[model samples]
Target: MIDFWLAAGLLLLVALSFLLIPVLRSRRAQLEEDRTALNVALYQERVAELQTQQEEGVLDAAQMDAGRAEAARELLADTEGVAAPRVTRLGKPAPLLAAILVPVLGLGLYLHFGASDKVELTREFSQAPKSMEEMTQRLERAVAAQPDSAEALYFLGRTYMTQDRPADAAKIFERTVNLAGRQPELLGQWAQAQYFADGKKWSDKVQALTDEALKADPKEVTSLGLLGIAAFEAERYQDAIDYWNRLLEQLPADDKSRIALQGGITRATEKLVASGGQVVKAPVAKATALLKVSVDLAPDLKAKVQPGDSVFIFARATNGPPAPLAAKRLTVADLPATVELSDADAMMPQLKLSNFPEVQLVARISRAGKPTAGEWIGRSQPLASSTTAPQTLTIDSPDK
Candidate 1:
C-alpha cells in the first residue's frame, strides 16, 4: 500500500508538471517583456536629451542624427536576447487552479472508486501471516473488500470455526453457500457451524443441510463426519458408528484423520454393545459410479492450442444446476489420454454423478484456466449416469 501511494504521488507530480510548466514559462516571458519596456523608456529619455541639444544649437544636424542613432543602438543592445512575450489566453489563475485541483480531485475520485483496500489485501496475502488471528483478519478484510467473493467468505468462515467462534462461522458460511451455490462441502460446513453455534443441539435447519448434502454426494466427507458427531452427542451409538464408518471410507488410507475416525467408530461400537445391543458390522459399500473418458484435441485445433493450456473434462447433470457433477483437470499436453470421473472426483457430494440420473460429458480447452469458459469445447448427448461404457470426447468447436 505504501508503494502504491508513492507511485500515485509520482504520477500526480507528472500531471501537475503539465499544468504548471506553461505557467512558469509565461512568468519568464512576462519578465522579458518588462525588460523590453524599460529599455524603450531609456531610449526615449536619450532621444529627448539629443533633441533639446539640437534645438538649443548645442549640436549640428549630423551630430543630432548621430546621437539619436547611437541612442537607438544602445536601446537595441539593452534589449538583446529578450524573448517574445507570449499571449496566454488561460492567464495565470487557470493553470494554478488546475494544478491544485488535479491532485485533489484525483484523490477524491480514487477514494470513491479505487480498489486500494483490495490491493492491500492482495499484498498482505502474498506473505505468510504471523498467526491465525492475522490470517483471519486478512480474510475478513478481503471479504469486506470483495463482498461478492464466495471464496473469501468461505476461508473466513473456516477461520472462524478454527477460532471456536461458531456463531460467526455459521453466518459467514451461510453467506458463502448463498454466493457459491449450496455446494455439498459448503452445506456441510454451514451445518456444522450452525450445529455448534446452537450449542450442539440438533435443529431442523442443520438436519436439512446435512440431508441435502448427503443426497447430492453420499461420500461427502464433511457431512458424514458431522452427522457422526451429532449422533454420538445424542447417544445414538450405532448411528454414530454407521456415520463414522462411512466417513472413514471416504478418507485416504494414509490420512491422519483416518486413525481418529476409526477410533471414534470403535468407541461408538463399544458403547452400543455395552448398552445390551448387538453390534452390526456394516457391509462395505459397492463400487462408486465411475465414468471413463478418452480426451483428445481435434486436428484442426491442435495448432491453435498451447501444450500448457488447461483442459477440463467433466460430467454435469442434464437437469440440475450448471455445476459439474464430476470433473478432471489436465494440461493439453496430457490429451489423447484416458481419465476417470466418479464420486471420488465429485465437486459437491449432492451434485455427484451417482446422484444424477442423466448427465452430459464435456471437454474444454481453456487458456485462462477457468472451467466454465474456454477457447474450444466438445459436448456429448445426455446419457445414463450408470452407463458402463467408456466415453470419448474431443475439443473440436470454438467455445461460444
Candidate 2:
C-alpha cells in the first residue's frame, strides 16, 4: 500500500509539472515585459533632457541629435530579442488556481474510483499465507475489494466452511452462485454449507440444491457426500449406505478418502442389517445381465416440457469414460415409462454395461435430441449392474 501511494504521488508530481511549468513561464514573461518598459522609460527621460538642453542653447542640434540617437540605440539594444507577452484569456489567478486543484481533485477521483485495494490484495496474495486464519482473512479482504468476483467469494466460502463457520460460508456460497451461475460443483458446495448451517437438518432448499447438482453431473462428489452425512444424522441407515456408496464410486482407486468412506459404508450397512433391513450382496460384475429402470418427469416440471421432447435413458460406468455404456431413447409422451439396459444395447462391443462393477442410471429430456446435454435430467445412485430390482429415476432438476 505504501508503495502504491508512493507511485501515485510521483504521478501527481508529473501532472503538476504540466500545469505549474506554464504558470512559471508566464511569470518570467511578465518580468521581461516589465524590464522592457523600464528601459524604454529611461530612454525617454534621457531624450527629454537632451531636447531641453538643445532648446535652452546649452547644446547644438547635431550634439542633441547624436545624443538622442545614442539613447535610441541603447534602448533598442536593451529590448532586443525579448518576446511579445502571451495573452491569457483566463488570467493569472485561473492558472494558479488550476495548479492547486489539479492534484487535489485527481486524488479525490482516484480514491473514489480507482483499484488500489485490488492492487494491494494482489500483492498480499503473492506471498504464502502463514496460517489458515491468515488465509481466511486475506480471502475475506479480497472479497470485500472485489464484491462481484465469483472466484474470490468461492475461496472465502470454502475457508469459512473449513473454519466451521458454516452460516457465513452458506451466505458467501449463495453470492458465488449468483455471480458464477448454478454450476454443479458450486451448487453442491452451497448445499453442503447450508445443511450444516441449519444445524444439520434437511430442508427443501438444500434438497433442491443437491438434486440439481447431481442431476447436472451424477458423479458430483460433494453433493453425494453431503447427502450421506445428512442421511446418517437422520438415522436412515439404508439411505446413508446408498449415498456413501455413490460418493465412493467417484473416488480414485488410490484416494486416501476411499478407505474412510468405505468404513462409513460398512457402518451404515451394519446398522441397516441390525435394524431389520434386508442387505443384498451384489453378484460379480461378469455375471450381471440386464437392468430394468423406470424413468419419469417430475409433476412440477410437467408443464415446462413438450410431449415431443426426446427422453434419453442410459447407463454409464461409474469409473469409466463419460460416454454411456448402454442407452435407450423415448419421447416425453412415453415417459412414466419403463426401459431395460443390457449388454445388447451397448454403443460398442467392449463397453457393455455388465463390464463395469457399478453404473449410474440417467434419464435426460433433451429438446434438441442430443443425448449428452439436455434441459432436464434425473439420476440414480451408483448400483451393481447385477441388481435385478426395477430402478426408479425422476427427471426433477435442471440439467445445469
Q: What lDDT does each candidate get?
A: 0.90, 0.90
Model 1: lDDT equals: 0.90
TM-score of 2: 0.67
Query: Please, what are the lDDT tens digits per residue for candidate 1 over residues 1-400?
Result: 7889999999999999999899888888888898889989999999999899999999999999999999999998988888777676878999999999989999999999998888888899999999998998899889888999999999899999999999999999999989999899999999999999999999999999999999998888989999999999999988898888878766756689988888898888888888899878888556368888898988988889999999999999999999998899999998898998888788864456887889999998899999999999999889998988999888899999
Tens digits of lDDT, candidate 2, 187-208? 9999999998999899999999
lDDT of 1 at 260: 85
**Model 2 residue 38 lDDT score:** 100
Candidate 2 backbone overlaps, count: 0
Task: Determine the backbone clash count of candidate 1.
Answer: 4
Q: Which stretches of candidate 2 lie over 4 Å from their true place?
A: 272-278, 282-400
Residue range with the least summed lDDT across 10 consecutive positions in model 2: 279-288
RMSD of 2: 13.3
Root-mean-square deviation of every model: 9.9, 13.3
TM-score of each: 0.71, 0.67
